[model samples]
Target: MKRILLTGCAGFIGSNFVKTIASEQTDYEFDIIDALTYAGRKETIQEELNKHSFLQFHHLDIRDSSKIEKLFQERKYEGVIHFAAESHVDNSIKNPNIFVETNVLGTLNLLNASLKLFKENEAFRFVHVSTDEVYGQLTDDEPAFTEENQIKPSSPYSASKASSDLLVQSYYETFGLPTMITRCSNNYGPYQFPEKLIPVMIFKAQAKEKLPVYGDGKNIRDWIYVDDHNKGVWDVFLKGLAGEVYNLGGDSERRNIEVVNIILEHLGRSKELISYVTDRPGHDWRYAMDFSKARKELGWSPTVKFEEGIKKTIDWYLENKTWIEMVKGNNK
Candidate 1:
């Protein structure tokens, strides 16, 4: 069986990947590592750990180079699906240093280890999962972002991720570490942390509390189901050419306010609950993706439409209130 290392598998997108892609790829043994940060709880993935012998969870921070190196030496991973990073933009503004540490330096450490391990196996693959924010925002008339877009990160979080993306490219260029980068649009579905837009709105609307919408709530974001994004990542890892970058998008774009209104309407809550907050510093105006390359190359396209996906998301959050409290309690 092929041994693979998946970073941040306890978190939202990664956890969905663990429950879906990693679960189905039975021929591979996945060693998942997470720092157990506020967003990543061991409890989130405990069921999968119990169910699958091919899966193992390690409690270790990617920021710790020595530990990462030791783990690399022991496992000699044939492939790496790197999904760990401090992804919250508001939190990144509060503390950019940790974002650099975890997203940039931590990625360097993984690249270093992957380089060494590559000598043993000629086909070692490293897939860097990234975001569309690295291309910055778009004006209303602008076409959707594609692989040709220039790197113009607007937030510290995106800057850090862009830095790591360049590092992966460098390794592929200088030392010939076989790597591919997959930049995806905003993802939502089950297991998303409450701090994000969708869950936050759901929680507030459910509690009959005021929903905080940033600025005018007109900022646009392309939404992809976590499952679709994970499947695209797997496709890029398995079939993408080395040193290439792929864009995976849901093709579903919605305004922030529209999303909030949808949640409120679904919960049978009043729209007056919406409280417009000051715009976040460096908030991107709009984000859209062009995933035609992924569709053409990997035969992959999003299956779940936003209307259906959002309903699923709201229902999941409603049904799994216990999980919401459990994940939040870990942070406290």
Candidate 2:
């Protein structure tokens, strides 16, 4: 069986990807490494681990370079899907140090380890997952970001991610380490940490508590379903050219207010629960991605519509109340 190393497999997108791939593909085995951060939960991926003999979970932080290097030296991974990072923008703003350490330095450690391992296995591929926010904010009428867009990150989180992206590209350019980068739009789906917009709204609205809206609630984002994004990532990993970057998007653009209103309607809650709050420092006005390259090259397109995905997401949270509560409790 082909061995694949997946970091952050206990987190939202990583967990979803693990579950989906484990169910769909039987040829490859997975070695999942997660730090079990506030946003990551072992319970989220327990079912997949229990069901799939191909899946193994390791409680290891990517920031630990010695351990990371030792793992690469011990077992040769055919591919590496890197998803471990400090991802919250607000948390990054509060303390950018961890973001730099995890996203930048951690990525460097992985690249170094991969470089050593790649020498032994010539066909090794490294897939670095990133965000569209690395393109910085967009004007109301500005065109969506493409692979050609210059990196101009607006927040500490995006800055750290951008640094990592550049590092990955440099590895491919300098050492010819087979690497591909994928930048995806905002992702929303089941098992998402409740601090994000969709889940936060759902949690607060369910409790009849005030749903805080950052800024005037007019900020826009191109939201991709987490499953769709993960599928795109898998497509890029299998088919993409080395050193190339692919953007993945749902092609669904919606304003912050519109999303909140939709959740209220879904829960039969009042709009009075909506409360406008001060905008975050360096908040990006909008983020949209042009993923035609991924469609044309990888033959991949998002299958879920926003309305359908949103409802499904809401229903998931409603049904998985214990899961969400446990995650929230751990985060606290």
Give the root-mean-square deviation of each candidate in angstroms. Answer: 0.9, 1.1
Query: Which residue pairs show backbone clashes in model 2?
Result: none
Q: What is the alpha-carbon lDDT for the whole of candidate 1?
A: 0.94
lDDT (CA) per prediction: 0.94, 0.93
Q: How many residue pairs clash in each candidate?
A: 0, 0
- Work out how many backbone clashes candidate 2 has: 0
Off by over 4 Å in 2: none
lDDT for model 2 comes to 0.93
Worst 10 residues of 1 by lDDT: 323-332
- Candidate 2 residues 172-220, lDDT tens each? 9999999999999999999999888999999899999999999999999
TM per prediction: 0.99, 0.98
lDDT of 1 by residue, 1-332 (tens): 99999999889999999998898886899999999788887777889899999999999998889999999999989999999999999999999999999999999999998999999899899999999999999987799999999999999999999999999999999999999999999999999888999999999999999999999999999999999999999999899999999999999999999999999999999999999999999999999999999999899999999999999999999999889899988553
CA shift at 152, candidate 2, in angstroms? 0.3
lDDT, residue 310, model 1: 97
